[model samples]
Target: METVAQRQIHSLLAKYGESHLNHTNELIHFICIPAIVFSFLGMIWALHPLAAIAVTVVSLLYYFRLSVPFALGMLLMSGAMLWMLSVLSQDQVLKVSLAVFVVAWIGQFIGHKIEGKKPSFFDDLRFLLIGPLFVLSFLYRRFHIAY
Candidate 1:
């Protein structure tokens, strides 16, 4: 019996074609996204500590249907972003990280566009939270963590 997270991921893979994501490539995304968000936050007014907290809470609240594994991944990544931004230099790290995130998300958009399917999250915002977790699921499997 598939769990709800399993079902959602399955639906996405079915629509997008499993070929859309190479396992290693997706894991790279899992690692990189938080770094990008961290860097981007340093350069933006809305990226204050309070706002970051709000983003995490709001996104997680929207992710109830997802799963423990998926939720854990989100918490981990968001925490990582907060740490990286706090430690790194705003002028240098922020610019580079922002660029990387923009490029990666663009790739994601392109992937969905090629599938001729709108992003699942666009249908319901919680799926936006699922996008990164879908990437981390590969890492979880690689480590035998049971995501």
Candidate 2:
């Protein structure tokens, strides 16, 4: 029998896949999504340490509700990003994060343009959260792990 996570993952991936059918777009997403995640985390970290912690906690909780393995992976990834942010000088954190955020978004738009479809996030804001999981699903497939 399929788990709740499996069913949800399938639904989310189907929605996410609609706009990501182009090979070029997929390649672009492979590069940009992680950058966007890290940059967003960095920007939150720059606001205040507590803000960053709050974001991480809320994000992990959401992922946990969807799937344990995905949540665990995100926790590890988020922890590492936060650690890297912690090491940066206060001023550099905001600046570097801003730069990456802008570039990554540009890449996202370019991918969408190539795909000839608007981003799924525009239809439902939750796609913002779905994006990372969509990317992770590919890795899960590669590793032969059921998401």
TM-score per candidate: 0.62, 0.95
What would the C-alpha RMSD of candidate 2 be, to one decimal place?
A: 1.0
lDDT of 1 by residue, 26-118 (tens): 444455545445545544413455666776677666554556666777778777766766666645654666676677677656655555555
Off by over 4 Å in 2: none
> What lDDT does each candidate get?
0.59, 0.90
Q: Could you report the Cα RMSD, in angstroms, for every candidate shown?
A: 4.3, 1.0
Name the runs in model 1 displaced over 4 angstroms. Answer: 1-46, 90-97, 106-127
What is the overall TM-score of model 2 with all chains considered together?
0.95
Model 1 steric clash pairs: none
lDDT of 2: 0.90
For model 2, state the Cα shift of residue 67 in Å. Answer: 0.7
